[model samples]
Target: MRQGLIRLHCGVIEIENVSKRRGRVTVLDGVSFVARPGRVTGFIGPNGAGKSSTLRILLGLDHAQEGRALVDGSPFTALRRPLTCVGAVLDGSGAHRSRTGRAHLRWVAASNGLSRRRVEEVIELAGLESAAGKHVRGYSLGMGRRLGLAAALLGDPGVLVLDEPFNGLDAGGVRWVRDLVRTRARAGGTVLLSSHLMSELAEIVDDVVVISGGRIAARGTLDDVTGGHGSLEDAYFALTSS
Candidate 1:
């Protein structure tokens, strides 16, 4: 909701007239939004709003029947070493149950051609030092989420995309993630995070893209979209219900 120039490290992320379908159901329809660097772009809507489907296409996890999702003016498939360019926490469960926390990170680091030293650095950053040696299966939901974030940050990517990152977070975890996102934005990383709960998003996001029934319902700065109203919650209710 904060207003300022959009900084760029990886340029901008643009989703234009994108649509998706599964069998007889259409999951997304002409959905579009732009994510600028140095800002937290919140993708929000009620359940079944196509938030996840949109993110899936953006990450190249799924294909859109129409339209395009571009990063730095290029599709995700066009990027070399996509993971290095874009850190993602799409699933907060982390890695395999058989692997230890440290092992999981090491594998990810190795696959990305990153240094082993980075494994420890991300562990500390995610506050998982104590549990780093334990098997991932024993970790709590919050711990798993932290581990997922550590993996995402392993590359110090120019862009970060997180889906429902606050799903299993504790109050402390939520606060940590909020500040972490702002800090990452200030550090010049493009961030696109999704949450169904608009109230939680209003606290951290600078811009918002709301979707409903797989279509874009609203898009703009927090103040502009909300009309400097009482809160994003009020604006969200009006937009979605109307």
Candidate 2:
């Protein structure tokens, strides 16, 4: 399918026939999808359906056994400064327990030659101002998620990849994340977010890609993919239960 490459304001991702394996078991089998600029593309599927594996390949954390994953027309490792092209939050618990939230951001900023002013801006943007000076060890799961999101934004990359960002959020936190993602899209960023829950995705995603049995079972805008289906939940059920 031409390797799926196309120029986007947030850069481009071309994934084609990407498959992966762990020992004798196949985790991903001929999976391909595109995340365009200015939209929240929700990657949803049943657990063990290869959603996480696809994301891992896209983020360059793991290599595919077959096919390819490319960013902006180039392999991820080939980018001179990768973070400048994409920001990712694949894990929410990578922060140091002893460091205050602001301190953690400061170090990350310095590594990228960014200023502390930028750090404070994102901290406030993520609604972490009240918790900025506190150690991450004390932050609740929802709070930690906010901090992780702030870290991802510090790069101001045009592309963002968030894995299960709403997993532990409360109602308020969930709403906050929804707005944050939408705002990024409006600003011309491409957002690829993964979630196991279809109900939550129905509220935030512009398009949905359903993965199942280590492959893409359905993909399109919510309405295009769902068609006459009662709901995203119903469409999901039909695809996986077949």
Best by TM-score: 1
Residues 86-188 of candidate 1: C-alpha lDDT, one tens digit per residue: 8889867559999999999998888878988999999999999999999999999999999999998888787889999999999999998998899988877
lDDT of 1 at 103: 95
Candidates' RMSD to native: 3.7, 4.2
lDDT of each: 0.87, 0.83
Model 2 is weakest, by summed lDDT over 10 consecutive residues, at: 1-10
Candidate 1: misplaced stretches above 4 Å?
A: 1-7
- List model 2 lDDT by residue over 34-68, tens digit each: 88887889988888898878888887789888999
Residue pairs with clashing backbones, model 1: 1-206, 1-222
Model 2 gets an lDDT of 0.83
Question: Following a full C-alpha superposition, what root-mean-square deviation does model 2 have from the true structure?
Answer: 4.2
Measured with C-alpha atoms, the lDDT of residue 38 in candidate 1 is: 81
C-alpha RMSD between model 1 and the true structure? 3.7
Q: Estimate each model's TM-score.
A: 0.93, 0.92
